[model samples]
Target: MVKVKKIIFLALGFPNAEENTIIWTDLVHEFHLQGHDILVVAPASNKTDTGLRLEAGVKVLRVATYKLFDVGPVLKGLANIMLPYQYKNALKINNIKLDFDLILIPTPPITLGKTANWLKRKTKAKLYLILRDIFPQNAVDLKMISQGGLIHRYFRKKELKLYRISDKIGCMSQANIDYIKTHNPKIEAAKLHLLPNWENLPKFEDLGNIDDIKAKYGLTNKFVVIFGGNIGRPQKMENIIELAKNCTEIKDLVFLIIGKGTEFKKLKDNVTSLKLFNVVLEKKIPKKDYYNLLRAADVGLISLSEEFTIPNFPSKVLSYFGSKKPVLASIDLQTDFGQMLEETNSGFWAEAGNIPLLKEKLMLLYKDGDLRSKLGANGYKYMAENLLPEHAYNIICKNV
Candidate 1:
């Protein structure tokens, strides 16, 4: 017999639909399947009303707030700063309150300390911080905000407050745990827990008619190297553009970059200006279609800006793993993402900005179908053993 607990999740971005296979939704779905009572509190589109609604048997409280996610940095930053107050107010108006055992908060907005504090005081819930994005520093790394500048200093204080209230801070990688400990020594070391991203591993059988799916999306008859997810600054989409340019001479090999972000136009403009016909860029497709396109690919592509000092473990890589796709990554030296790839022998990686070496490695995979299959299978196995939703659920339940 298992105990059913009440859990509430606070997030800036959510999949919003069960059909969408996002990291947050995947883990929450695990709790759902286990018979836990789960509620997700998230930002609503400007067009959406603030209220409670049912989404795939889950209760979702959509808080009315400023601009939807993936907007320009100026609006996005301002909106995050304003969300805590808005979230706190929304709960007051709803009047459908109940006792909650745990408050799970994932950071990107990183300004939820106030809301967490309010919820803790009101519901007596234990707080767990999933530190997905190390703010101010990540912003500083991308030169989006200057170090010690007013914006940086303000969010830095907010980050510390968010940490102070968390009973345990779950990090995506050991590098992330080490970085947090070294940078924020004031926080107790034991508070940081390694909670890597997890996903619902779907079987290949569910992919459904690979050739039909690929032809549907114009991905057939090519060795597709797909990069599917957010195209934000931290991703350093320029490296991808340059790689596409360098790979122009290679026939039948196309770089498929799917997803939308602030930098999408810049990437599209570069592709147009450079006349790189081999690189296909699309705004993100429907969830299952994206998965099918990923599975149809010869390999998955991952990139991080060379400027990043924080170790970014992109959860999207799990999407690649779930699809049994090998990876070709251009990563920052500090990230340890490449290290994970090497440890599993799942893909090829070179330091970010090393176009020549990345090209060489890409060619190695391009020429060897057997190597791709072996590595892709290895990645799928690695994901099943270590990064499944059930595994993550067990870890979080133990903490709860």
Candidate 2:
């Protein structure tokens, strides 16, 4: 006989249950498909979206709170700080009375530590912290929050409490594991495991015609290079505009950016101001739409701010691999993501601020179709072998 565990998933961002954005949804849905019971707890996306509901057969509790992202920093911080208490009250009002076997938590808001601890104490479930964004420290690195200040001191306690309470800390990369071990020497190595970001390879019925999709986005006549994810401070999207500025004379090439975040307006304004006709900025679209855009483009782009010290791994690369599209990244050196690209031959990268090197790599891919195909194939093979929700499913289940 096999165990059909009851799981609780906590996240700041989640898509509609029927749709798969290939982030946390896939992993939790994999558990659902495997006959396990799962419940998701998240902040309400809008005014009318509050309370309990069933989504794709899984119970989802959308706590009435401030919307999580795509807002100013002050509002974002308020949302994070209030999330735990908000969730606590929501659970009580909704009469959530199940015994959960395991709880999965991902970080961006470490303020959930208090709630996670309370839940574990109540449900007697093991807690797994999916350590995606290291907090307080990452904020300090970005110069968003001052070190040794009142706010930093408060969040620093939450950070430690989260780690201390989590039965297992699943890091996005080995670099993440090492950084934690170095900075927080009291944390035991036994609990920290390498849990890379994963995605379920989608089964789209129609990818649409490449030329039609390209024309739909005004990319029909150019060798399109696309960046398809959050346009935020951590992404250092300025490097993207700089790359566009450098490539203005390359008439055959165009840069396509599709996503919305804090920096979206700034990037749009800069694109208009620079008169860089080679660049196109579009709002973030559904995952299905993004796949078609991926298919129509010649190359994928990933950019990270140079200020980051955490070994951050953005899951966007998996989308390129799934579509067999080669990537070009300008990212911080702290992350081993660049090295992963080098090892897999999936793409090329330069340190985040290095526009000259980014331009060089972009040209190499732009000129060589054969090389692009080979690299893309290599990435596809790697993703198939290692980056699926099934892999994550096994990791979480076995560990718990």
Candidate 3:
């Protein structure tokens, strides 16, 4: 018989949000199915109040906190710094007590070290750090924050403390693992592991009415290329807009951008000013509707800022694969996402900021139906075989 363990998960987002399909939700569900007791401490959205609830064998504690991602840099940083104290206060007020066997945390804030350390000291829980975004360094790479600046130094100190507190650190890709090791030479090699983001195999219900979706979006008879989810600074969406601008002559091609972020307004303004008839920008749709839109499109587009030295992998590619849509990604050369596509025969890739190459890729996919079908199928197959919640669960179980 497997020994059941109690797990504590820390994250910024959780289920029942406007968009619910994400890495943490899937993994927590999988752990529940495996008969492990789980507790999730997540931030409450603007619409939600601080509370406790039970859902699908997982106990959720929603801590009332400032909106972390949608605010200004100063506000965001302040929230990140204060989240641990808020979480601790919530736990105390609720009189919640448990001896957790494992504590799992993902980083964007890198300020959860104090909470994790407290839990470890109190309950002897083994802390596992899911190192998704490499915090201050990524900010520095994007020139969002300067290296050795006050903000950078403060977060860097927090980053190191988090790493030191973790018993194990799981990276999203091999490239992520290497980047961490290279930058933080003090961190022991034994603590690092590759723990890629995962999702369940596509369910029949997820594939909504493709024809109706295409018509609703006015994508009928057009070779639709979609860039979905979080159109922000890190995405370097200007490259995609440039690609759309260059392809205005091709009446059959339509660039459908569905999502919102800090850069959404800027992108929309540029699209309107340029009079790019071939491009359409829409707010993020419901999760089900987004999947339907993916089914309606001929290609899925992924992009990262060319300025990044970090090999960031976007989880959006998995959604594209789930829809069996071929992907066309423009990523930093340092990122191994392009290599993943080539090795899997799942999609095509071009260097980020290379509008000419991006345009060439678009035209190639537009002209070839057979090539699109083959690549899409390959991606679906690869995802089904490799990127599953069960795989991620097993990795965590072994480490714990």
lDDT of each: 0.85, 0.86, 0.86
Q: Kindly list the per-residue Cα lDDT of model 3 for residues 168-213, writing each as its tens digit.
A: 9988899999988998999988899988879987565746678888
Candidate 2 residue lDDT tens string, 28-128: 78888999888899877786888888878777888778857767777889888998998889888999885888888988779888888999999888898
Each candidate's number of clashing pairs is 0, 0, 0
> Which residues of candidate 3, in runs, are more than 4 Å off?
1-4, 17-19, 46-48, 206-208
* TM-scores for every predicted model: 0.95, 0.96, 0.96
**Clash pairs of candidate 2?**
none
Quote the positional error of residue 227 for candidate 1 in Å: 0.8
Candidate 3 backbone overlaps, count = 0
Output the lDDT of residue 179, model 3.
Answer: 89
Q: Spell out the clash pairs found in candidate 1.
A: none
CA shift of 330, model 3, Å: 0.6
Model 2 quality (TM-score): 0.96
1 against 2, candidate with superior lDDT: 2
